[model samples]
Target: MNGRFVRLGETGRARVAIVIDGQAVDALEGDTLITAMLCSVRHVRQSEFGEEKRAGYCLMGACQDCWVWTDEGERLRACTTVVEPGMRILTTQPEAQWATLAL
Candidate 1:
């Protein structure tokens, strides 16, 4: 799939394999999560408020727009977090198994 961000330079770095929302993506070594994500996908994550998708507000860690989660429900700041090999990242929050159960 085509990504939002186009990699112009620095294409010779080592590649790191990561899974995003069940799809395999290749990220460069020493790249931040946001850089890795935006390079492989259109939007970083869907907005919690609505259907709108968010890329990132601030490239730095000062904003909360780049928040992402792991498959295990751990929250991570994409702007500051580095991409790791074999990492499984989820763009959407995993629903609780009991969420649909009646009280």
Candidate 2:
């Protein structure tokens, strides 16, 4: 066995690819958009103040870094959302509606 390498288990595996910014991005099969996205590069999570690139932590649903949009014109949390074949996702501003937060 190579001392510099170790095999990955099923749990270590990730998604293959996803569409973002009008492009198909590579990722693990099970990775969230946040994980799958920034894996290739930073900036998946845009800084609140500027355009500096950022990445996500706690791949779980704790952090809100995985927010995105679906081809259906619906907003969703990337960490909580699973990949569906040909399903479009948008990782930008969520549709703001007054009725949703009036309570």
Runs of candidate 2 exceeding 4 Å displacement: 1-17, 47-52, 94-103
How close to the true structure is residue 43 of candidate 1, measured as C-alpha lDDT? 87
Backbone clash pairs for candidate 1 read none
TM value for model 2: 0.56
Candidate 1 TM-score to native:
0.90
For candidate 2, lDDT tens digit of each residue in 1-103? 1111122555455545567655676555665566555554444545445555445556688977656666566767766776654555554443432334565
Model 1 CA deviation exceeding 4 Å by range:
96-103
- 101: Cα error in model 2, Å: 26
Candidate 2, residue 42: how far the Cα is off, in Å:
2.2
What tens-digit string does per-residue lDDT give for candidate 1 at 1-103?
6798999999999999999989999999999999999999998988877778899999899979998899888999999999999999988755532354534
